[model samples]
Structures are given as C-alpha cells and as structure tokens.
Target: MKRMRGLLVLTILCFLISSVTSLQAWEILQQSGFSQALGDIFFIDEQKGWATGYQGVIIHTQDGGKTWSQQKVELPCDSELYNIYFADDKHGWVTGSYVMGDGFILNTSNGGETWKIFKTKDMEMPYSISFIDNKKGWVCGFGNGTILHTEDGGKTWDVLYKPEKNYLWRQIFFENAQKGWVIGCESPQKGKFFDTIMATKDGGKTWQVKYYKPVADEDWWYPWSSIWFVNEQEGWATICKKEATLLYTKDGGETWTKHQFNLGSWLYSVKFINQKEGFISGNLADSGKGALFHTKDGGISWELTAEFSKSLRKIHFLNSQEGWVTRSNGYFYHTINGGKDWECQLEPKTHLHDICFVDRNNGWAFGKYERGGGLILHSEDGGRNWDKQRLELPSGDWQMGIHFMDSQHGWTGVSILGPNSTGAFLQTKDGSKNWSITEIEYLPQDIHFSDAQNGLMIAEIEGGPLVMSFVQTNDGGESWQVRNKVARDKELGGRRIPSRIQCLNAQQWWVMSSWCLSYTSNNGKNWTQKKVPDTSGFYFLDDQIGWFGSNRLYHTKNGCQDYKEQELPMPIEWISDIYFKDSQEGWCLGNRYYVGDSLERCIIFHTTNGGETWEVDLKSPQHLHRFGYASGRLWAVGDNSVVYGIATQAVSALGKQYITLGKVKTVLFQNYPNPFNPETWIPYQIAQDSDVTITIHNIKGETIRTLQPGRQRAGAYILKKQAVYWDGKDDKGEEVASGVYFYTLRTSDFSTSRKMVIFK
Candidate 1:
C-alpha cells in the first residue's frame, strides 16, 4: 500500500510536469518604453480604464491609473490602436489604423478579459470610434473619407458615408443616438485649407457643415491633429498651422470661441469632465515651453498645469479631479487633485529603432533622441535586461542606423533636421560602453562595416541636387572621403518612393527607390540598376542567390542574372524583410490576406528548402515590420515597440528539412568508442546556422581544449556525411591523462554538455 501511494504521487507529479511542458510557447511580447505614446485612453468609472497606442498596445489599469497591465492582444504588424471607447467595464469598443492597410475594431464583453475581433470590409482605416451604447456606434477616418456605422453590437458594419474624391476626415464623436460630430480638413483647388466640422442630427440620414475656419490653422506642415466633445453643443478642437489654436463651441456648433496662446507648442488632445471643467495637452512644435493646460470655468480662462520635455500624445480624466496623461518619451503621468499635483507611473519599454546582436550574450539597440527612444542600450545577458550607454552626438539628433560587426566595434548614423540639419557618424571601439562622433556631411542614408576596418557609408552630398555620395572610412571612421556621387535621378523615381535600405557586409549592398533596384559590389564606387516594377523588398543569401519579396515572391539563384516570379496560395500585399540560415531554412515577413478572413494580416513565411516550399510561421494580429537574427535567436520588432523572439532550442523545423534531416532538430551525440585507445569521433547536428562551440573539461571543471569555435552555418548533419574528429588530443595535440571528461555543445538558443569516460 505504501509503495502504491508513492507511485500514484509520482505519476501525478509527472502528469503536471508534462502538461506544463506541452504547450507551444510561440514568443514573448515585450512592451518597450516607446509604447507609452498612448494614442487614446478610456476610463470606466475611475477604476478600470484602457489605453491603446504605438502599435496596437491596449493596456488596462484597475487601480485608477496607478498601475497598468498589458493585455494579450493578438494584433498584426504595424497595428496601431489609436482610439478606444468603453460604455461600461464589461462592454467596449476600440479602433485603430494600420500603416500598411485598413484599420481594426476590437470589442470586449467581459471588461477586456477577452476580446472578439471584428473586421470591416475593404481597406478602411478608422481613426476614431464612438458608441452611444454597446449596440449603436460610428467610425470615421481617411478611407477616402471613410465612415462605418453598426447597430448590431459591431457584428456588422454598413458604409454610411464616403466623401467625394480628395476630401479626408477623422475624430468622430456621437452624443446620444441622433447627433454626431467630426472634425478634419477638406478644400477645393486654389482654395485655402479649411478647419471644418460636420454634424449629423438625424442619425445617418443627412449631414451639415456647422463650423469652418477660412484660413489654415497654426501649423501648415500637416493637418490639424485632434478633436473632442463633452456633449453635442459643447466641444473643443486643437489645431496647428504655424502656431497653435484652441477652438471651443457652446451652441451646438452654431457659435464658437477661439483662444490663441503662446504655449509655443501644438496641442493634440482635449478632455472635459463637465461643461465647466476641462484640460488639454500636446507637444511643442519647436523647442519651447508649456504643454498641459487646465480650465475650471470652461474655455473662458486657462492656466498652465504641467510641462513635459517632449510632446504629449493623449490625455484622460477619470473624474473632475483624477486624470492621466501619456507622452511621446514613454512617460505616464497621473493627477489626483486635478493638475495641482501629479505622479509618474512606470512601465518597462522595449521599443528601439535599430537593434543589433554580436553574440549570444551581447546586444545593443538605438532609437530616437529620448528615453527608450533614441538613446543607446547594451545588454550583456542576451537582451533580457538593458542598461543605458552614453552615445556622444550633437544634442537633439536621432539615430537612424545602429550596426555592429562584433562585440567591440560598431557604427551609428545620427541626423538633426531643420535649417541647421547636420548628420554625424559615431563609432564605438569598446563595445557600446561609449560612443564618439565623426564629421559626416549631409545625412547618412546607409551605413555598413564589413569587418573591423573595411566599411562603407552612403551620405547625401552637401549642398547638392538630391545626390547620394559614396564615402569610405579605412581606419574605422577615423577619416572619410567621397568615392562617387549617385544623383537622385528623377526618371528612376516618380513611382513609389523607396525610403529604406539594407547593407550586407561592406562589399555587397542593395537599395530600392521606387521601381529602381540598385546594387553595388565595389563599396558603392559603381552601381548596377535593375528596373523591376512593383518591387517591395529583397534578400540575398549569397552573391549568387537572392529572393525578392513583392506582392509575389521572386527568386534569382544566379544573382540578378535571372529572375523567376512565383505566385503564393494567398494574396500578399508587401514583404518588409527576410532572413535565411541557409538554402534549407528561411523566413519572409510581410502583409497577407487569407481566404475567409475579413481583413488582411501581418504574416511570417518559413521555407525549408530555400524558397521552394513555404508555410505560415506566424499570422499576427499586430503588424511586425523587421526581424533580426543573432547567434541562433530570431527577434521581431514592430509598431508598439514590442519585441518577439525565439531561441535555438525552441527552433522546430516541423515544416522543412536540412539535407534530408533525420529528426529536423538540434542533436548532440555522445562521442564514439567510449573506452577507445587514442581517438574518437564527436558528432552533432543543428537545424540552422548557429555559433557553435565544443569544449572538453576535466572532472574539476578545468578547460582541456576547444574542438570547434566560430560560426557554423547549417551543414550536413548525418554522420559520415560530415563529422568532427577528436584524436583524444588537447590544444597542443598531446594525449591527455584522462579519467572522466565532459564535452559540451553551446549555441545561442541551446546548450548541453555530456559526461563520458576517458580511460587511458
């Protein structure tokens, strides 16, 4: 009976262990500090509120803006949840527009515990969504002046209105069921840009233009940003042309008041708890002062509340007294007694612009010129945690590219725009502990270093006619010279502007501008152009093999000498980037539409035997833009500053094989002839190319010799095909006095050591 009880307990423990281990863990989603540029915030009774922004990030705080928790939102790449509205804790609706295509609407029934995704027809980018109840709602944005209306709890939507040709609108608000208002810009040719607002009083039957500013607003660079309404008659709109203006209306848009202030900034959002109390927040257009403002007696009088260094993106108030705000620098601020006193809420951030990893343990990321945005971060523990490293460049400059060849050497290009727009190139010698700048004229469009010395940089020629100057730095960015100039030929563009570049080593590089694909081999000294129409992205595995990712997939095994276009099972819009470990393992990141789905999705395609056969690796709800591979780990980064990754051990080639793989996995076998006389064969197989190291250690944990080091691309895994022979030798090729020995196989995502007897 005692033995049976023990066995039953042991069986239960094993079951629990197996159940926990059986789940397929895809990847971890990390919300970096850059995600806090909250686009919109909604509060359900001061306690529960949801905020969404910067890549479809929707976070909920049950503690009155004191703490926020990130929800498990399965969004596609570049999915930005720009606006949110909640009727109550249990029912709510959210809206967002993706950069690639269409917008998204998400509904929750159990207070955001779970979300049911609803798709709208065609490619509609809904920026603002409003609801009178859970059943009746309206959405409006720039889908050729797009507007969607739903009455059945958003299960279905009808296109109620679409503006004529060049007109665009956003920021829709509905007070009760019959009255709704929207504010945006629309004007005729040779006519001044109008600050306009339209109203619908009888549901969706008719519309009226109620308010208009004949001249453009303060900032002429872009259209006005945001609008809000406490009720049908009382509303506020923030506009910027060259300066800033706050417009308020009282008599149902019939009469309005304008307040011009020297906040030296462009206001973005407005919120009012009642007709008598309100607040506004935004960023300074230039470097000035005064960001947040408060008014107790309506818009009659306003007072400066608080100021942030960067710009504010959103503002929300739970009651007349408690409020919350989010800024572009990934900061969250909350106020208890109105704006008299405020507190900062902290959240971890992972959003960076350019990221690079040198080994399994060393990595770095750079963003804009703010915290978690433009500063440099170094990780010694394989990106689990990061510490800020000072990068010396001109103040207010932003890093465009951060590339590293190894642990100790790297280069960064930074640019500051305006009248005094200057570009600086920075290089670090001792890893990323510090950075020093190099004089780079114009702007650095692309930066690459093939090795510790041979590197290439492409910068715009100073005071030239949109020309790209090829430059080289021989002594690691110590000095640079112009090799040649590639002028921005007008005939090459006037199609789709190519705003991206990729560099492979220093000798080979690829750049796409519009329909023109340019390649350079002699460090950009000369260029070869290929007019490939409808080109989106391209990846080259070697000088002779490459693949182009457009609406369809194209391959060129013999460099660009020959191209073959292949059609996919489903329609794909565009592919951003691609990576391949070898001819047998590859990945493609792009936007795709699957049959039976209402809207398109951001997807990842995996190929086993190069680009011969492909399958979906990940079909995400949020959009993923770029992917980085280092050591044996693949990391994906996108809109909301979120990071997703998979390590070597987690790499499962269930779809493709590497050279008629036996198990399609990473395998390390025990050395042959355990009690042999003088020599043995050490055999191992990895599914993909990884940094592999094999070391022998004695019983007291002392290193005996290193069998293999450096990068080993995916190779023949079967024994007798290719094997590493160990002649029972040490580093000096001497037979070691051995009793017990341990051999270890370590890579980025995988590591295992086996013990063996070394009898002599």
Candidate 2:
C-alpha cells in the first residue's frame, strides 16, 4: 500500500509539472510618461563597468559609454538606493535605504546578471560602497562614518571602525586591495560641512585622518561629491564649492592642492579615464543646462564641451570620443566623438525612473506615467523614436491587473469600485488600442488570465468587511460570478471575521492580511489556507514555488506545505510591491517598516527563479512607489514625477516624457456630526482601496476612537462599523474631549488625513 501511494503521488507531481509547462508565458508590456533621475556610477576598465543609484537603479557600458544598458540591482520594491562599486566586471557592491525605514546593501558575483543581498544587524543607509577585490569591500552610510568591511566577497560584514561621531560618508575609493580612503562630512556643522577624508592602510584595522581640517575651499561652501585614486599617492577629489568646482588631492593624503573650475556650476562628478584623460559634469550656473568638461592631462587643465545647463549629475567615458552623461533635466546626452559634442536622447511620454538596454539596438526600460501610475517604454529604433504605452492594473476599474497570453492577446482587469462609480473587465484584442469594458460590481485587485477567454479576478466586497473571489468570463462580457473565498475567515484568535486580500493571481494564488496563504487548483472553488511562516504578500510563479514579502522572505518550493524564512540584510521591514516577468525575471518594491518615519524611498529587487531567491538589479535604481509590467516593458512610478527606462537587456538611456492624468479638481470631504447623539454620516470617494481606515483623533494626534479601519467594498462610504450612537466616551468608556476633535479617513495606501470637527 505504501508503494502504491508513493507512485500515485509521483504521477500527480509529473502531471502538475507538465500542466504548468503547457501554460502560455507572459511578457512585459508598454509604458506611460514620467521623469527620471540618476545616482552612483562606477567603471571597471573604462569599457565595462556598472553604476547604481536611487530605486535600485543600475546601468552598464560595454562599448565605453557610447550607449548603456540597464542592469539589475538586488534591492527590494521600496529601497532608495545610494551607491555602487565594481571590483571587476563580475563583482560589485550596492547600498541604499528602505522605504519603510532602515538601509540596504547587496553584492553581485555574476557581473550584475544576478545579485545577492547580504544581511547585517547594523545594516542601515549605506550611501557608498567600494570593493578592492573579489572578496574585499567596504560600505558606508547612516549618520556615522561607519565602515563595514567584508573579506569573503560580501558573504559577511564586520565593523572595522566607527568614526568619532556621526558623519555622512558619501563616497569611498580604493586604489589597491589594502589602501583605501573615504570622503565625507563631519556632523553638527553650523552650515555646509566640508569634505573630511579618512584613510586605512592595514586592511581597515587602523585608520588615520587624511585631512582632519576642511579643505582650503571650505569658505566657498561646496559639498564634496566624488573621489578617485589613480594610485596610492596620485589621487583626486571633486567638491562642489560655492560657484566653483574644486579638484584636490594629496601625495597619499599628505598634501592637497585644489584645482580651478572651468565652469561655474556645481561639479557633481569627476572621472579619470586614464592617468592622462579625465572628465567633469554638473549643473551650469543658472543656465538651466548641464555642463561637461574634459581634460587630457589629468586634473591639470579642463575644456568645456557641452552645456545642457541642467544638472548633469553623472558622466561616463568609454574612450575620449564615445561617452554619455546623465542630466538632472530628465534626459541623457551621448557622444560618439568624445565629449566634443552631445545630443539628447528622447523617450516616450512616460517619466522614466531607470533605463537599460542590452546593446545599441536592443534594450528595456522601467518607468511610470507622469500621472501617478506605472509605465514601461521600449525602443527598437536606436532610441531615435521610442514607443510608449500603459501597464496592467490590479483591478477596481483602473485596469489594475493585466496578464499577457503571448506577445499580443492580453487580459487586464477594469476595476468598477468607486464612489458611486463602477468599471468593467477589459480585454485588449489588438494591443491596448480599442478595448472592451465589462461592467462588474466587485472591486477587483488582481487578475490573471490563462488564455483569451478564461481568467480569474480577485476582488473585495462592498463595505469591505470581507473580500470575495470570482472566476470571470469574457464570452462577450455576458455574466460574472463569485467562485469562492480563497480561504475561510478567521480572526487573530480564530474568531471568524474576514481576511483582507492584498494580492491575487490565476495560477497558484494567495491572499494576505490575516497572515495566511491559500492554494487552489479548481479556480477558488476549494481552497486550502496554508499557514505560512511569513506575514506579508505572497508571490508565486506557479502553484508550488513562491516567496513571502514582508520584514523577511519566506520561500516555499513545495507549495506552502512547508517553508523556510530567510532574514534580509536590509534594515527596513516592508516589501511594498513586486513584478515578475517570468520565473526568472522578477522585481520587488519596498518601504521602511519602522514605527514613525515617512520617507518612502524606492527599493527594487530582481530574481530569476520566480522568488526562490532574489538579487539586487543595480542598473536601474529609483525611488519608485509603484511598478507594473506591460507589453515588453516595466513601469515604475513614484513621487515628484520621477521615472526611468531600462532600455534593453544590455544597454540603457535616461530621459523624461511628461504626462498629466487630467486635472482632478474635485475634493471629497469627510463626514460630519461626529460623536452625535444618534445618527452620523461619513462621506468619502472611492479612488482605490482594498481597505480603508476612518479613525477619530484628538487635536494632539491621538487616536481618540476607531470609527472604522478595515476593508470597505469600493465606493463612497457613509456607513457605520461600530454603533452609530456613542455615549460621548472614548474606547475606555470615559467622556472624551468635547470641543472640536478630528476624524480622519484613509485607505490601504491612501490616507487623506483630513479632519472633521467633532462636537460633544
């Protein structure tokens, strides 16, 4: 009997594997319009090197910066990446900050094709990184000039030394495996803190202050930007002083001479291609254009090349003729004739966050629409004219959920849950042009379609006390019906209430909010809620393999029947969003999960095996708040109209395409007559939500009462969760503040923080 049972199980497993293999694969789609900014840069040999910055941004150059492709860094969905250093072509290090709170650090062994994020208890905002060899590296960030040293190729980190006080060490460089120096600032400064350089000789065991006093140009007030060392004795540093750019150096930190600026803009970057040739780029004093200067005799003299007048934040040179510079104007300039001339690269109307292309011809981009949504842009024409489009939405009438059956036929959900407004279930028979909208009642969150006709929609109910599931049909948009809840509802203590659904898909799906994941094969008809070890959103490339996104990552290859939790090295604790192109190509967003910090920096991570493991894609980093995959591109959207484009598999170009979501002038106010004797009404709009929170707070920002904080079926809400009549008391049944209290209503990711005066 035992043999028979084992044989049957094996047969079932094979059948399942075959079934999954037969399913059609999905591809990334188009994008909208937005802005793009850049950060840290590094070059291995002048021809092959990588740079990383905000939003896990990464970029690579193989043909010497003539063109670049976006690379991937191993950061989460919401980490505001900082710096990156490449030891050679294959080994590198990246650091950044978490959106929710804390810091991030990651390393790559495979030439940035993949990266592994390391963990350390003290891992915070590591703004800069430097790797001397394959196994020796250093990372610095936070308020302190804390230097973290790693010997085993980033397998581990040890605190070699912490500076006397907190200093923002922005950049670090190493000429050899043992000799290195760091450029930063001392804290508690009255105004502008000058560069305070530190050096270590014996593998970081002992350190000496290279320049204890500020550089002579301190009175000019330019923050130190970048540092480079041609050798232990011959090195240079760039500091943005007043209106002048200063390049100074020491015979190994013993004596320093500040170089004269060729232009008046703040020199953000300085690079030496050889001991003979170098370049500098930065903003052009009120010119509103970027300035680029080149030098053939090291830092001796400089010549102005092109002036875009915007902040040319970064510059990379392959040879003298072929180079590229990224500007703060949301554009990138490329030159094949060295820095003598330049031309601006244009992208679709979508604001790009980061960009990468495999070669001059083939590339990929990640960005978002300027209207506060995600987008993906592509270029088949050497970037002369780029095409733009939109990504799939989750649901609720906004086309939140989208899944491509092939390169053409795609299915996305049209959410229909707004304040007295409803949407449809849409299908693009011809690649997002003329569409169809099937009116539905439930507020959809995510949708997955296996083919053209069959699909599933994960939606929530009205009043949101619970979430509902449904198997949808596209047979002329005839009828849609509920299938089953992915799992039965259970409270924190088994008191059946309802589980708030965060994410859902077609094949191998899971629901969150109750810290439980349910698996279903028969289309949500029957679900087996698997008690997972992690407590956030669950993503599965298939029914068996999946990853948990939260404070840590819990992975299960055996379909949640069993799982293992892996603690991330990042100091933050929130994985905000995720995107997976295939089982192998995936991305994640993160926000800080601390108690009371509110800077939602963008963190992005990539994976190849679904979520079995993840690595930071440093090529395209930005502080993206949201992302989506559409057509053949990825879209990342965030604050300040910031976006990017990962041009191709091997190259990337930066640009901005602005778009407005159409003016929304109307404002929805909160409810009135709070703490009324009997009847009260709370008014709001249904923009987007799987959950909402309406709480009453006192003047001092204290939760005076919990009016309603849970799932609300999409639409305008004026309902009551607790008793409509209150005895004029707090939760403890004591008479609360009488005059002019406030009640605030918010949603899962949207908080109005609006106030309504409550009278006793």
**Runs in model 2 lying further than 4 Å from the true structure:** 1-29, 32-36, 41-53, 57-74, 189-194, 212-224, 286-288, 329-332, 343-760
The candidate maximizing lDDT is 1
Residue-by-residue lDDT tens digits, candidate 1, 366-427:
65434423456666666555566434334453436677988899887766554676677777
In the range 1-760, model 2's lDDT, one tens digit per residue, is 0011111010111001011111021111222222234555566664675655454567676865555667666465446666666767777777776543466577888888887877655754677777767897888765556788888988788898776665657677777777888877664323334467778777677777766545343332344477877777877776665456464665786666767674655777777777878888765666646678777887777787777745677776767777767766445566888776777543323444333333343333334443234443344432333444454332222324445454445544434334654444555455334345555666565565554666666665545535555555554234566776543243332222222222344444555444567666765567777776434344676777666645466667887888786443233334545555565666666543111222224445555555556544432223444454444555454433343334323211121122111211112343445324323565554444456656767768888667554664443332243212334467786766433456565666566554433222
For each candidate, what TM-score against the reference?
Answer: 0.55, 0.45
Q: What lDDT score goes with residue 635 in model 2? A: 49
| Residue 341 C-alpha lDDT in model 2 | 73
How does residue 375 of candidate 2 score in lDDT?
45
lDDT of 2: 0.54
Model 1 clash tally, residue pairs: 29
